[model samples]
Target: MHASAQSQQHPVLDYAISHLTDLIAFDTTSKYSNLAIIEHLRSFFADLGADVSVLPNASGEKANLVARIGPADAPGIVLSGHTDVVPADPKQWQSNPFDMQKRGSRLFGRGTCDMKGFVACAMAAAPVFAEGKLKRPLYFCFSHDEEVGCLGAPAIAKYLASLDVPPELAIIGEPSEMQLINGQKGKIAMEVTVHGDGGHSSFSPQHVNAVEYASRIIAMIGERSKRYEREGPFDQDFSVPHATTLATIINGGVATNITPDACNFIFELRSIDQDAAQTDMQALIADVEAALLPEMQALAPKARIDWEEVFSYPAMGDATGCETFKKIEPILPARGGKVSYGSEGGVFEIYGGIPSVIIGPGSIRQAHKVDEFIEIEQLSQCLTFLDSLDTWMKR
Candidate 1:
């Protein structure tokens, strides 16, 4: 039945929509501090009698929130989502990006689908899991800066691991259209800056051109990506089917008449196997420094290249066998699937020692779009699924 139609009997759906409305009002873009939204969530959960903790970054600008309901000594499932979102240009949107607008069956807003929708559902269900009779704990894991990189999840994972009764498994709510996501590729993101000297265009030969060297590195990355696509070390489960690397952003040069002084570029590798991918990344960086440094140094002794790690999240292997996964088997999708997108699941497993599954409301296609939205039907679907989860926990 439709979400609006089901709302009369489904108070959870009503509460979810109410929570989502308030959540979307926060401008939690990655570029800005998300402390406001984090505080809001903290208060909400604390008021409901759940144990809530806020882990802040060194700067105290961003934070990850963990909320627990039930006995502290019992293992439980984690409900995860990111609080931050990509920037939304007001010009591209029909209404204010922070204002949730109901249009037909969809709720339009910047983070309505990318995340906060699932967060709303989890929050709405908090009371259910907090009842005195709850057998095990229910943990809500929310992080910041996921749009930039999964910068906050590691802290949450580590914190969970440090607990006496850590989470056994996690449900990463990342706009999966309520389907079970068994696996996903990991990501390795890096930023490389080439330093050189600027000079007149006519004297380019005498001065090292940073842009030119950056292009060489980009070309090398392209060649490696091509080889991976053409060769056999592939996993047919992922849509891309192979490790892929590419330069996503680059900045260099000034006037057309002047040789650039410096160039900065960013690149990433999305891989089915993180070990192999990391190895390839290290080799690629080494080759660039070896091959291009000499040429640039020959012209200018001070010329050099620097590389910095942006951020990365591990790839999730199939989660069908996870202990917590089996509990919700009745509601899981009949068949499993893998995605090229990276998520906190892998890090939760590797870092927190928790197995994980990815499932949530809304399609990823709605994420980060001009008029981002989540279907009301999907909201109902998530509530129904959560009911099944509650039953499992009660049993």
Candidate 2:
């Protein structure tokens, strides 16, 4: 028998998998609007008798959906996910990525794993949670723009932070093949642009090579990376226990005969510490600009070297003794290790004071891939996990 058969089966989860095909049909690509899906969820939750709150983004094009089931006074768990899927090109996929198709044990689509699967499973369980005579509460939080540096969740988290009945814990249902994810690496994305005087290639000495100068800045970051690796404070569970990565996107240089006047590069670092991230970035950029810009401006005197912070997601630490962690361990096989990927869990940890953990069906490997899929067997296991959750709550 399927493990879900061990307890009273939740009809809500069954409903979720069936409706997931419909949800996946809409192209909620990160760059586009998710209004159709958001509206559908709003209606579905409201019909379930949940008090739904839809928070709109600046453009009013996308929204974050928050639904509560149970008494306001009771502390509860928030089941979190994003409504956006990364863009998928038809030519890159073997099947229609927007259309959910089922083969033996697998459902294939654009977002079958990178996370609509968890959202579907959570939605399937919602009705059951709503009907139960509960001691605690359950909150469903679906956000937009998670693919874009977790931009959508901050508003929702801020709203929750303002509430008198803030959630006690948050379970960010990012795919982890059912393991509990307790840690994440921090991230800092920046774009560095170098402006130098333009001159003829014959007079190349009179103008600075912006691309060359950008390479020097990139090199500076690389030197810092080595130091971050040997003498840093990262947990060993990570594949690389260090502040890793310095990627530069090279753009500019019109003709080989002309000295390139402007070059811009975008780079990022994934780390375990914020202060270390900032300190390394500031020091490296300061030194590189101090060394390079003066020589460039000697030709134009209007040369510039500057950077902008695009976005930042904090690193997560292990959550060994937290109430949220305690709630989920009994249902999972065993405690799992840290993952390098970033999630909205970091925001919940810092802003909501609600201990958060990432756990759900599917694998990170399959997430956001061309032929993305989740095993029906995994869905069955998730249903069983939810059953365990019901039993645990009852106890």
Candidate 3:
């Protein structure tokens, strides 16, 4: 247990803790407007003398903020976090989810752990970053729509790639309980739609049934899941030793009486090995089209099989035997390993050409859950960790 809000005269940490309350107060739920939260942050950064750029999404309902401090001439580090928070169920929470509450050492609120805390820490240090004369630059990249699909980050990453000088490294401040995560699995989300002729259920073999066809696709995915595990290149550290998947969405048939006209299922795969996963996925979809679609088309020439890639997060792996690890590895806990969860680290590693890691306060367990919170002690520890980075960057 620790003291409430601010315990001592650690100005930056205290500011971070207080700022978390303001950040958490905004209902930046993934479904709601993140514009308000992003605007607040924009003002904060501008006041800190940061050179700010706000990139709006297609709808302009959300924005991604890229702020740079220090010498733009040199490659630096990016501190990245998402502005959106997962929706909170009011009935499940003890206190108002938006109102930060302190009980013992923990600060209870939505987005407290899942990542406003990290954003707050970075925001608190804005002045220090702006004032310090440093060898390299520091970029703060805040994105939107991360919980949905890691959608917002790709655009920012693309912009960063276009920069004449991009960051040398990116530290994605995901809740790792202060552990450093050097690698993570890639994710691919696909929506498969099956269309066939509809007829009266009473008349058997008169028309195609979409639900049946959709079931076949589901079965195919299940088979693929098994194959991903039994195959080689397995990493034991991940919860799933190999690629894993499950159908998250399925919709078909208007009523129980009529034959189903169309069916759609959304499925996702988390893969440790990107190349093998992509190859398998391509082959599996081709097989389905070859084996399954032709039969449906013969029955009803209008039948269709469609697969649209909705989202993708590339696999992340730190280059082995690099000085980057030698420099930062000691700052992290000893148990660093891969995880099934995906992050913007992929965008930094694969797109930004910067080695990246996931390290911050809070627990992934508390993220996106009822009564989401971060321990005050964890925040204290995170301040120290940031200070270490500050020292490193200064050196």
Candidate 4:
């Protein structure tokens, strides 16, 4: 049905949609356990008779799966995708977010556009890869908690690094409307809680106001963001062309008449240079510890600030020059460049020492939004890429 805006109904497309339909049924939100979806993938890969390894995280609540088909001795390609999706609010959606709905050549579902579409395509092609006459192996790497902080990727990358011969490249399938992505910003998400001695409003000066200190810290981050915006060691390949710091959640004061005892806020920093960003954050902390903490401690001896890490992933450098890119360049739908958003592809490169690229079906504009969907044609295009990969492997 490639004519007149009709569905092509190819077997790969059909299989991918079938798998995607099942995958969307799973409520593998980042905050929830992803064991069920992990199990589904494990079973699927195991049934294919591939070399499948299910590596569970330390908490045993989530897991990552790596399945290798074809020749193992030779360096191969790794297809990576995340299983977790951001939580969906039913009230915000026109239909059930977890239930897959096919409408006018697009597949509607929560994870359909953000990821599962690519994962489904990858899995749908597993059988073909299994049976292909391959010179190099094809590896399928699926992980959990990717939506949260690339948490599942480290373990998968570690496992790949331990291989006799690591894969040649990692292609992360983050929704990019099928554009090739060579770079992305790294991220560190954290929560800061300021502790103080609460007292009546009359004694506010004597008591450390947690909300006041929290606001001060937020202001400091805002200043750093402004400085970066003004004097950026900029990367123009990204749409924003500059690093960013954002405080998304802040909670502090309980009552207007009383000084708050505690304040906590969650913030994130996205940068091209994560180490430098972290260094600056540490410097900010040192400045506060040296100056602000003592001032608060003068009034409340037990006053302190606590910093806890929520999640973190490294930024990937440009990989457009990698030999592997040349192998698949001819099939690229759009030009390659950097993206403002982050992906596990960065960790696959930085943590696992695998060169990486990002290209996949669907627009990011559809991801994490109400009525998320991926164009069915994109899945068809992805199938062509996967099949062409087999063609290259055989050559």
Q: Among these predicted structures, which one has the highest TM-score?
A: 1
lDDT of each: 0.88, 0.80, 0.84, 0.86
Clashes of each: 0, 3, 0, 1
Once superposed on the true structure, which residue ranges of model 4 sit more than 4 Å away at CA? 1-11, 289-291
Model 2: which ten-residue window has the lowest total lDDT?
A: 1-10
What's model 1's lDDT at 235?
86
Question: Which residue pairs show collisions in model 4?
Answer: 1-8
Residue-level lDDT tens digits of model 4 in 136-255: 888899999888889899999989988998898888888887778888899888899999999898988888999999999888888878988999979888877888888889998888
Q: Which wins on lDDT, candidate 2 or candidate 3?
A: 3
What is candidate 3's CA lDDT for residue 385? Answer: 76
Which is the better candidate, 1 or 3, if ranked by lDDT? 1
Every model's TM-score: 0.94, 0.92, 0.92, 0.93
Candidate 1 at residue 164, lDDT? Answer: 93
Clashing pairs in 3: none
- For candidate 1, write residues 76-179 as lDDT tens digits: 88999999988999998999999999888889999999899999999888887776466878899999888777889989999999999898889899888898
lDDT of 3 by residue, 1-395 (tens): 55534446355777888899999999988898798988998899899888889999999888899998877878788899998888898899999999999888889999999899999888877777677776778899999989888879988888888888877778889998887777788999999999988978887487889999999989988888887778746898665678887899999998878899899999998889877778877988997888788889988999998899998888877643466666655665655677788888887777777787788789988988899889887777777777777766777
Alpha-carbon RMSD, candidate 1: 2.0
User: Per-residue lDDT for 1-395 in model 2, tens only?
Assistant: 33244223444444656867888898999989999999999999999999899999999999999998877786777889999998898899878999998766678998888788888887777766777766666788999988878889888888887777788778788888887777778788888898877778899888788877888888877877777777777677765667776775768789988888888988888887755778777777788878887787887788888799888877666666876566656675555677777789888877677778788788888987888988766666676677666555544
State the lDDT at 320 in candidate 2.
61
lDDT of prediction 4:
0.86
